[model samples]
Target: MSNINPFDKCPVYETINLIFTKVKEEDAIDLFECYSDPITKSRMNNDNCGGVWDTHNIDAVTKGIKGWVQEYNDRFYIRWSINHKQINKIVGTIEIAPVPNTTRFWDGACQTGILRIDIISSLENKIVLSEILRMVSDNFYVDLDIKNIIIKATKDDGERVLALENNSFDKLENSTFPYSDYYIK
Candidate 1:
């Protein structure tokens, strides 16, 4: 939405080959198609595991993607559609948030924290992830002065884990939530 150039050259920051391009509102439909499909949803079993669920009802998903773009377009960082060069299709999405210097998660010695990334299973491969992480680490994360990278993906999301491990993502910890209450209620 904003005219900010996400791919602008910066002398202070080094650029990674993978570009974190903003996902447009119009692209939500395609995402829904990918995310809602049985094969696609089965590949990644996060919150949207139950076949898109009712969260996609009433245009909520579309609105959320668009709003996220507007909010994080020029913020410290944000997510982007993972556009594979060979495939030439946005097989997945990833988030890169630049942690503030003052956050409690900082180690004091590091000026910047980590850039978190999220991805779908469609792009889950060692080679594919290696290229993407290289792009992010070299082009985006390094420029942000970040020392670490974090990823939030599902356990069944093999591609994300494979890519994360290939990119040197150590497991922080495990997080669990009571799902039946949220869904049934």
Candidate 2:
């Protein structure tokens, strides 16, 4: 595995339909749309992360983006804006961080990465989610040096659950978090 610090120079990933890059101040408008939407706010996984997902204005979104940038500088976690290639707009943000040993996992102990994907409800279909998960599967394991990746998917999110299942992620039965089911790959 490479010992490179991903935070040193943030990595940019691109797939046929999406592009992932470090969140920027300019993304406030597009991101505000996601944050302010009721459906999108309902699907966001805000566990562990201190920030509130829902926002009422562009300033809140801009402040949030600044916080994300600060978090990146501190090497806490890297948040990437998920840009839809066809629309040339940011549809969501994905965060990947090394799972701290303090957090409980199904297995006793293992190297893991915790993934959080917050996207617009309109693009919450299996196809779109599958593509995003595929990009994570293809790159994050090696980049983060983790044996497994875990994500929280609520039972109500049928499309996201299907996408997780289709992308080699299994529902973890013994998750400590009660709000949502955790999936591991």
TM-score of each: 0.59, 0.90
- In the order shown, the candidates' Cα RMSDs to the true structure are 8.3, 3.4
Clashing pairs in 2: none
Candidate 2 residue-wise lDDT at 76: 67
Tens-digit lDDT string for candidate 2 (4-76): 6576778899999999999999998999988888999888887777666559889989988998899788766
Q: Model 2 lDDT vs. the true structure?
A: 0.84
The CA lDDT at 136 in model 2 is 96
Q: At residue 96, give the lDDT of candidate 2.
A: 84
Best by lDDT: 2
Question: Cα lDDT of all candidates, in order?
Answer: 0.49, 0.84
lDDT of 1 by residue, 27-88 (tens): 56556655655565454334322344333442865875776676464443455665545545
